[model samples]
Target: MISVVLLGSGNVGTHFFKAIEKAENVRVAQWFSRQIDSIKGYKNKTAITDNLSELMEADLYILAVSDDAIATLSSALPFENRLVVHTSGSVNVHDLDKKNKRGVLYPLQTFSKGAEMDFKNVPICIETLDKKSYPILKEVATSLGSPTKRVNSNQRRVLHLSAVFVNNFTNQLYRIGHEITESEAAEFDLLKPLIMETAKKIQTLSPYMAQTGPAKRHDKKTIEKHLDLLKNPEHKAIYKLLTKSIQNTHGR
Candidate 1:
């Protein structure tokens, strides 16, 4: 059986715990959190503790904490020369304490507290200098129904930056769209289908080829009207910047 000790009580840790619970041949040996109350629910199911000295020896110790806390936490682990991994997209696999086998098990998706995600559909990115632990991580991903990929630190960094543009920046644009609709006393939900279709289109078509907008078409009048409609200076600036970027991309 593959034993995993999850160290963190945040959204990623919580989601991983649920995934590992239903996975076969894998069991959680213990959970570590500074605040025991955060993970008290799992007390009856598995060992939970705030003390690092009480940490159990496991095949893999997965640190699912914030990027900033990863290095410090891994360095403070009591044991050494064991398989230890972190679930971060941007953080380096080498960030883990060198005393242990370092690896990255980055799931390329946004996680929310109490949000249910289908792991089977999520992509898991793994990177490690020690290939010995690859099988264990691969098996865990397979059991959780996630697709696995080997991504080195440099590649993972680029992927994280792209994710920021595609996911984070896009989400901000959605919020802006909602604000605009709300200002006009319109239902933001009305744009849901359009948003969904925009996402779906990129799955089958190149974004450049799929591009269709006033900016892409070089419709200066329409773009001007959109900029004029925005009451917020920040929104107008963003609109102009995006419009100019699109025009330059398409040679409009």
Candidate 2:
């Protein structure tokens, strides 16, 4: 059995803990946080400690802390040469302290506090400086039911930035759509099908080919009407920028 010491109590840490719990051959050796009360429920399931010095002997240590904290936290670990990994998409694997064997096990999915994520669909991006450490991370990924991909630090950074465009930016657009609908007392739920269909289309068609809108066609009249309808200066600016971007991209 592979023992793991999980360090952190945030969304990624909680979700990862839940995923690894279902694994048959992997066990959480300890759940560490600054405050023991933060992870009270896990106390009965595994060793819970705030003291870095008292960490149990484990085959792997997974740091799910903030990107800035990874270096200091890993550097403070009392032991060296043990397999230490972080669950960060953008942070370089080399960013972890060199005192221990450093690696990354980035789960390419946005985590939320109460949202339950199916590990089967979440891709685990693994990286390691040592060839021998690769199998250990791959085993953890497989055990968690995640599809494993070997991503170098640079590739992971670009992939993560692309995710911001795909996921984060898309969600912000949804918020703007919601605001527009709400202002007119229209049901925002009415757009669910359209949103879902837009996403579904990209599965089979290239996004450029799938694009269909007034902006895509460079309908100057409709674009002007949209800009006029937007009362917020910020919203108008966003509308103009997007419309201009679409026209420029399609050579309209």
Candidate 3:
């Protein structure tokens, strides 16, 4: 069996570890985390260690830590010849020194602890230092039902930025919408249907083609009224700026 020592049992690590455990010919030899108490449950199924040298038995050490800590943690790991892979969307795979076989296994999706993941549907981008490790990485991803794509460093960085705009930025907009409706004693649930429809329409219609609202139609009165209704300075500025941007993008 190909063994894995997972580092940092955070959201990404937790999710990946669970999925990998279910796969054939793969077993988690151990898990490493700073918060040993928090990740103790994982230790019941496999050995869990706080020491770095305990990772020597595993074929690969998957560093699921933050991008900022990748360098320091990679340097701290003791094994020179063991395959080292980091699961990060933005960090370059080459950031790991040439001492070992280094690679990346970046799953392009948001992971929340205790939430189920359908790895089959999520795209997995893989990158590697040498050809020898490609098969191992690809097999690991494919076994989890994820469709694998080998991406270079530059393309992965660009995709990470785009994902942020789509997932993170769009979520903030939803939060803002919820706050605005609640302040008026209106339930945010009322907007759920409209939000669902907007997303569905955009799947088939080009985002520009699916455009609606006052900004698209140049309904100056409605736009002005919305601006007037927004009492908070920050919210009002955001509304105006987004409206102007939307109009500029889709209007004459």
Best by TM-score: 1
Q: The CA-based lDDT of model 3 is what? A: 0.87
lDDT by candidate, in order shown: 0.91, 0.92, 0.87
Write the residue-wise lDDT of candidate 3 on 12-57 in tens digits.
9999889988888777888898888868876679888787766647
**Alpha carbon lDDT of residue 73, candidate 2?**
92
lDDT value, residue 164 of candidate 3: 97
| RMSD over all Cα atoms, model 1 | 0.9
Q: Sort by TM-score, best first: what order?
A: 1, 2, 3
Number of colliding residue pairs in each model: 2, 0, 0
TM-score of the candidate numbered 2? Answer: 0.97
Worst 10 residues of 1 by lDDT: 113-122
**What tens-digit string does per-residue lDDT give for candidate 1 at 121-183?**
789998888888888888878888899998889999999999999999999999999999999
Poorly placed runs, candidate 1 (over 4 Å): none
lDDT winner among the candidates?
Answer: 2
Model 1: residue 28 alpha-carbon error in angstroms:
1.1
